[model samples]
Target: MVTAFDEALTCLKDEKIRITPQRIAILEFLTEVQTHPTAEEVYQAIEKRFPGISVATVYNNLKRFTELGFLKEMNYASASSRYDFSLKPHYHVICESCGKVADFYYPKLDDVEVAAAQLTNYTVKSHRLEIYGICPNCQQVEGE
Candidate 1:
């Protein structure tokens, strides 16, 4: 299977999107970090190696990646937006107290899409579910 990095780069080349060293670094970061990180977090991590790299670079490329379907932008009412690199269909589980995000998968939920399509005039092309609650680590700390 083509790696996420390969697929994204291929898409960019096929679409005539300009590829830059900073963008490549950002893509590498996202592919390796695995954590769903905000733009600021990405900037902080990458700027040391590329001191000239600005947060705007991170934000702009992140926006472009999402527009190209290379990444998924998530909103948690955070001051910054988080980006997910995993392209597979899945749901998000966000910790209410800690602001941590993790993936949640349940194949049965696919049925909901069909039901939604049946009940509404609009076509249901995709779906996402976000669950909020205290995470295990936070619960442990709070219990202490």
Candidate 2:
């Protein structure tokens, strides 16, 4: 499997985004965390290892990566936004109790995309899907 860091570098090159150490660190953190981290969370983690990097840099890089189609920005019912490095057609299962997230892959989405393309006059560029529910842990805790 291609490592997330390598994927990020390739994405940067493809989008003609400058590849700097700070950007790489931000990308690496996004890849490793896989928790759909917030900008503040990313900044705090990167700050510990990288003193000179700023919170603004983290936010900017996240936006650039999203434009490059390498990362997806997710919004919950809560106030804050989070970032995910996985760009493929997949859905998210979010835990309501603890706020954990899991990625779900659905092959049927390709068919759905085709149907949507035929139904709409406008081009269907992309789609986002997320399901919110209580996780197993939360269920177990509630059972107690």
lDDT of 2 by residue, 1-144 (tens): 888678879878887878888887887788788588889999998898889888888888888888877788888986678888887668989988877788899887767767888888658877777799998999999999
What number of backbone clashes does candidate 2 have, counting pairs of residues 3 or more apart or in separate chains? 0
lDDT per residue as tens, model 1, 108-128:
998998899899977988888
- Those runs of model 1 whose alpha carbons end farther than 4 Å from true positions after fitting are none
TM-score of 2: 0.78
Could you list the CA RMSD of all candidates, in the order they appear? 1.5, 2.6
lDDT of each: 0.89, 0.83
Clash count, one per candidate: 0, 0
Q: After superposition, how far is residue 26 of candidate 1 from its true place, in Å?
A: 0.6
Best by TM-score: 1
